[model samples]
Target: MCVQAISNPRSEDDQEKAWQAVCPLVNQLRNYYEFSIALEAVVVDLLSVLCSDEMTSRQHLEMQQSLFKQFAEILDFTLKFDDLKMTNPAIQNDFSYYRRTLSRMRMAGGDDIDKDLDVNNDMANRMSLFYAHATPMLRMLSDNTTKFVSQNKDLPVENTTDCLSTMACICRVMIENPNYRSKFSSEETVLFCLRVMVGAIILYDHVHPVGAFAKSSGINIKSSIKVLRDEHPGKVEGLLNALR
Candidate 1:
């Protein structure tokens, strides 16, 4: 019924045996439908469940919160390409729901209004809700990757280049939420934004090594930022402009 119920691989021997038999047919379906389509479906379902108006009651909120926490734990477990390869449409739906839930939680936490500012102590408490709700999910995702590597054994801890993906996701958030920049004075908001930037920058550095991003992209950034200060005797200077 929940995303967590469907997202994990069956650990039982009989379940794995069943999946092993179905793997071939699943590959056939993969040929007809790209993996990304399936990924999107999963995201959509999870979002629907999370944002449903039916979950408005305080008691319902606590229940959903608990379930979300569990979903985060599931993410921590190792998820393999094979583990996700199943032929059962129903099972696949479940798995997709789980993955989508993780993505939704991650983005929502990062984009929370109260996360980046210090306007009030109450804001800090509100920001804590994001962390409290998300820590488990973060741990789950991390654990899932780790478990995947452990299971594969031969897989190396190679740097993964995810800059374009990160940038694109950030762009989507910025475009969708125009007020993000205006919350900079809020302590919770600033902390969250800084964390996102720092994490992204670190990932980029790890992937490209030797500051390739700075060398390749900094020039464009600087040129785009340049502005003319005067008209008669034009003085041009590059300045970091706020989007807000």
Candidate 2:
């Protein structure tokens, strides 16, 4: 499904075709382990598309919400599948990650707090453009998933250590130049990407901790952290010290 989305993407026809190819897999994802992990991959890809600075449009935001609603339904439904046995590490891990992510999204959307007009518009625009291009794939994923994650509460997090580390790196980058980070306002977008990266790294580290990141990337991370501290003392001294 992922390969098809990348290899043959141009028109709605292509998108729908690719979606159809993967739509049948949802029924096979009967287990919580399969469902949550797959859902995580889908959410990450969708977020990457929506968060990119290059594509900004209203259509993308609507699509993002549409995708979110679908996933939410899936997760919500899936939450009821099997017993809520916190003792099962797989179930626990998947549930935790889902809750954390959903909470983050809702918070970012300002569902609870009062919205800032400019910030909201910027976020909405970026998300919309992302969905315009990525929705078909997400739709395919939505079709494939059997369970839905609930939105009223937080997405779960089985392990937050790597997430914390990635966030630390992101803060370092943002403090260096919060004003010019991405297409959206420089400040929060950096934070948002940091959050995603952290979550991804956490998942990766869960599988391959020692080499989760390339040596080059690690060096870059180390160097970036140093530069941030040296050039932007106020931003880095307190915030990104843990990243290194």
Against the true structure, whose TM-score is highest?
2
lDDT of 2 by residue, 136-236 (tens): 22232333321212221142221222222443354445545546454556544443443333333323333333533567233245544444445435432
| lDDT for each residue of candidate 1 in 181-242, tens digit (9 for 90 to 100) | 56456544433332333233322333343432476631122222221121111111111111
The C-alpha stretches of model 2 lying farther than 4 A from their native spots are 1-179, 213-219, 223-244
Instruction: Indicate the residue-level lDDT of 241 in model 1.
Output: 11
lDDT of all the models against the reference? 0.33, 0.37
Q: What shift in Å separates residue 219 of candidate 2 from its native position after superposition? A: 6.9
The TM-scores, one per candidate, come to 0.22, 0.24
